[model samples]
Target chain A: GELARAQPVSTPEVEAFLDTLKWDKNGLVVAIAQNVDTGAILMQGFANRDAISATIASRRATFFSRSRSQLWTKGETSHNFIHVQDISIDCDRDSIVYLGQPDGPTCHTGAETCYYTSVPMDEPKLLASTLYALEELIARRKTEEIAPGAKPSWTRRLQQDPKLLCSKIREEASELCQTVEASEGMERTVSEMADLLYHSMVLLSVQNVKLEEVTTELRKRFGQSGIEEKSKRPPKPTAG
Target chain B: GELARAQPVSTPEVEAFLDTLKWDKNGLVVAIAQNVDTGAILMQGFANRDAISATIASRRATFFSRSRSQLWTKGETSHNFIHVQDISIDCDRDSIVYLGQPDGPTCHTGAETCYYTSVPMDEPKLLASTLYALEELIARRKTEEIAPGAKPSWTRRLQQDPKLLCSKIREEASELCQTVEASEGMERTVSEMADLLYHSMVLLSVQNVKLEEVTTELRKRFGQSGIEEKSKRPPKPTAG
Candidate 1:
């Protein structure tokens, strides 16, 4: 039954699109799947022509498992499929992006995305992905049961006390403002801003809000600005 | 002069690290370069053993250019070299990360990163990377000269009027609080929070504060939490 579903589609449009791809010698191209809603890059893999065809036809992100040397539909067993809405090829034509919505955590480790681990540094540091990571960690702490006699985590305390969470947000916001008014250097401004972001994220988690929702809202505003700017530009020259 | 500097280091430590890598059939592995300070992933490319060696030895991000069939130092021509501070391999050992500081924008198109293009959507949308993108856009608008007779953009107005900027931040922050106090649904909460985040970023930009600094501060806090948690864990079992 699965094999039948995985069969490649050979429509004229599909064929035309596939023809433009610059597959490597191994007849594979790099394919990256991104969460359309959250904008999190879920995972990356290589896909052969069949995999691409299957992905488009099934609307499920499928990739060539280099180790297994066969096509693998992500979440086939886990049932956390990345249901692709649209696929776009990069300017290079050698890479493809499957903009999709994931049903559950995309990483096998149960993390939302695969790109969680940051490179080690001389001093402890976080990656840009830390925003998403913090969201996940805060969520985990919410449901996690404290060991018997173990102190409740700060996150737990904040989650339990709504007033505390809100107060922290306001307090952090004020500190952020102080940094600006005091003409604090970059370091202090960043520090205060970080505190505010962390506290805001805690409130979001307590309220059962996903960070993706916030990002999606931001994207909407950015797109509106882009549209406004585009309308002011002169019309493009049509192809001869 | 550059050639001498690109020589691969062949120390035992380097050799040991290289041996752990599971290179592809083409003797290459995916190498991602991230800005250590800002936590921005600057670019992704492939690297061989020699490329990795050269990167470690030179402390500059290096990659194997498949098209050119030779080692190439990023920013050799652009002078936007990513000065690597440390390198880390993923758990799979099939990929690597070079965490470094960028001298300037990393993309050839002058974008902060190459991952700016989002997949085409039925409705216009912004990617999660929009936060950094917005910062760049705001910064550009601050210095951009308005064309004669052209209207000043909203960003331009915000930049020119500090009072307006500060007021907006305060207003958005209050709205965000109202969402919580009034029991606003997820949609409204996310919308207000996004507005607050956007305004906060604008203020940070006006203050010449980089988003990376904020992320670094958050990372330091996360690390402190990690350290506290680790101290409580039972010691690992020793090898026989």
Candidate 2:
């Protein structure tokens, strides 16, 4: 039960640990909050000694706002708290990480994380979680209302016209297959595949399905070949 | 052809853009480098005016080393240069992002990115690119020579015993399927899936197969159903 609680802030051990930290000239250290379950970095900010102490005492992630020049606990306003489970300092002791469980979306923009924005490049790029990003964008588009006399975006048009969306999906998928059958170059193959993925994601969003559900289904099939083999084997004897 | 070259650094346009940046008290701003192709963040550091100018002029990602009190281009020593394609500033104008193509692994430790380590947690966790990380770890283990009398790791044992590895993969896959058949909770399903993914990754490493190859194959299958429908359609009229 004690392990479930935050480490006592008044302890001598914590005091010594804090003493070892190498704070910058402004008496602040870079602090990163990582989702304990997903291993995604939710956000990064600066923290002072008081902020760190407040985090430990309250079991909530707290940061020192540079402009405000004061400590503010995350989710104090949004109620999307990152519940700190543990705090760790980097090897160099100049930076810290708060391993925590977020109650809701951590970003102010309502994206999963603040680091979603990628540096602009000319070539098409795929983020590690591009599918997830696409899903989020599509979901946002689905919920957004169009104003009077406003033109509907391509995504909005797809969301409104179910038949058109379905046809587009089929069209993109067929194109993707043609790329493979024609022995098209890697770039064409990737481009077609991306189109298929995008259209498929939009369809999923229309159906109120999450991308995670699809990934989970794929994960299930990863072990499908072994199921038959497992069934053929004699069941292991269980002890009473 | 013009798109291949970096924007001229001496232009008044570049000067005006730089003027809008909100540098910190020390005349430094946060800089992040992202892989142009993969969309992975390579690393982050602080940059001064000189560092930004040097980066734009040289078409390389450069940062100000606070400890060294000088500007240094990434991969200057390692030769794994991040060739800048473009630079972008955040909406706040307080941070900069360099979109670049890296020559090799960006991290000094040989991992693809510096953001590999997830903050420690008691429960199991999975990163967005856990498979890639596992592949990298397995590859490292494959190459590293064991010190005299040092005990071999579990991964080393798997690498040494091909049959054992195969059996383990099958076993994990069966267990994963069992989680589904037995109506196990979501946690169990996710855990088993993670196990299967890990073992599969290890197998891929042993066989010299990359995870990207597997994903590409899956991408091909995303269009498989449409191939049949496309085959039934009449040929398009040839254009004059």
How do all models score by TM-score? 0.65, 0.55
**Residue-by-residue lDDT tens digits, candidate 2, A104-178:** 888888876665654434344333233343555567778888899876556667777765665565455445444
Q: Second chain only: TM-score per model? A: 0.63, 0.53
Every candidate's lDDT: 0.71, 0.60
Q: Please give, as one word, the docking class of candidate 1.
A: incorrect
Per-residue CA lDDT of model 1 for A149-173, tens digit only, reads: 9877777777787766666666666
lDDT of 2 by residue, B1-240 (tens): 223222235556556667878888889887767654444556778888778877777778888888888777888788888987667655456667676678888877787766565443433333333334345666776778989987565666666765555555545544544544455655665555454455555555565655554444433333243322332454333211
In candidate 2, stretches whose alpha carbon ends up further than 4 angstroms from where it belongs are A1-13, A34-42, A53-60, A83-92, A97-101, A115-240, B1-8, B34-42, B53-59, B83-91, B97-203, B206-240
Docking class for model 2 is incorrect
Candidate 1 collision pairs? none
* Candidate 2 lDDT for residue B24: 84
**Window of ten residues with lowest summed lDDT in model 2 chain B:** B222-231
Worst 10 residues of 2 chain A by lDDT: A219-228
